[model samples]
Target: MLRRLALTAVVSLATLSAVTPAATAATGPVPLPLPLPVLQDDARARLTITVSGSEDSAAEGTFELRCAPAGGSHPVAERACDRLDELAGEDEDPFAPVPEDALCTLQFGGPATARITGTWEGRHIDTVFSRTNGCEISRWNNLIPVLPNVR
Candidate 1:
């Protein structure tokens, strides 16, 4: 009985080892998780800035801005791209709007308005900016060449 038990145990072990490799092979190799920066490398930033209500025809026209290999109709593409990269490195969202509950000075900058639509850091952006009030004006200025310096 002792010999029979040892033989059964040996057979069971062999069977388990043989099935393990087959099961693993059937499932295929496991994929490694990509690093955060590696995943972010695929993200692209492309935007279209359209300004209106400004007397300057230069500032009123639509312009394209592409980063991560900057090339577009924007007057200062390199500077704009650098600014965006700086913002990204600082963990800031360049297209973020002013908070509604925040208090702002009651001052009208001008009628100059801009609409920025496209993708940034692989995220879709469709936001409007205007120099209507202090908050809005500040928001518009923050983007500088990205939105055209209408101030």
Candidate 2:
């Protein structure tokens, strides 16, 4: 009788071991595909802007704008989208550096900095903006609608 009980215990242990992995595998979460872009043509972009300046000024915000619809969290979404459309129309790169020989004032616009990362016209964009110099300041101001709160 003892031998028979031991045999039953061994069979139960074997059954549990065989079923455990299959049950765990079946219960595991299934992988899902990443969501598609909001716009098919890539005319939309989601931007996160962080603003910081001299000892006193600091702000941050985010925007998700689509040119065709002209919408997003930006305070001036329409204007921002228009500005971006203009850049695309002119075949100009907003993130391009200012001319090396261009003259600028010796003024200081503070140490404000901005980082823009998103998709533009089907292209991935990652750029930084700052008021450290004349060119950078121009770049920062040119993108005003998108960085509205940065003064």
Scored by CA lDDT, what does every candidate get?
A: 0.80, 0.66
lDDT of 1 by residue, 12-95 (tens): 767766677767788975454233222133336689988999867888889998897887899999898888877777766768
Model 1 global lDDT (CA atoms, 0 to 1): 0.80
Per-candidate TM vs. native? 0.69, 0.59
Clashes per model (N, Cα, C within 3 A): 0, 0
Q: Per-residue lDDT for 141 in model 2?
A: 82
Segments of candidate 2 deviating more than 4 angstroms = 1-42, 54-59, 98-105
lDDT of 2 by residue, 74-109 (tens): 667788887887777776688676778888777667
Report lDDT (Cα) of residue 48, candidate 2.
Answer: 51
| lDDT of candidate 1 at residue 70, scale 0 to 100 | 84
Among these predictions, the greatest lDDT belongs to: 1
Error of 2 at 63 (Å): 3.4
- Model 1 regions lying over 4 Å from their true place: 1-43
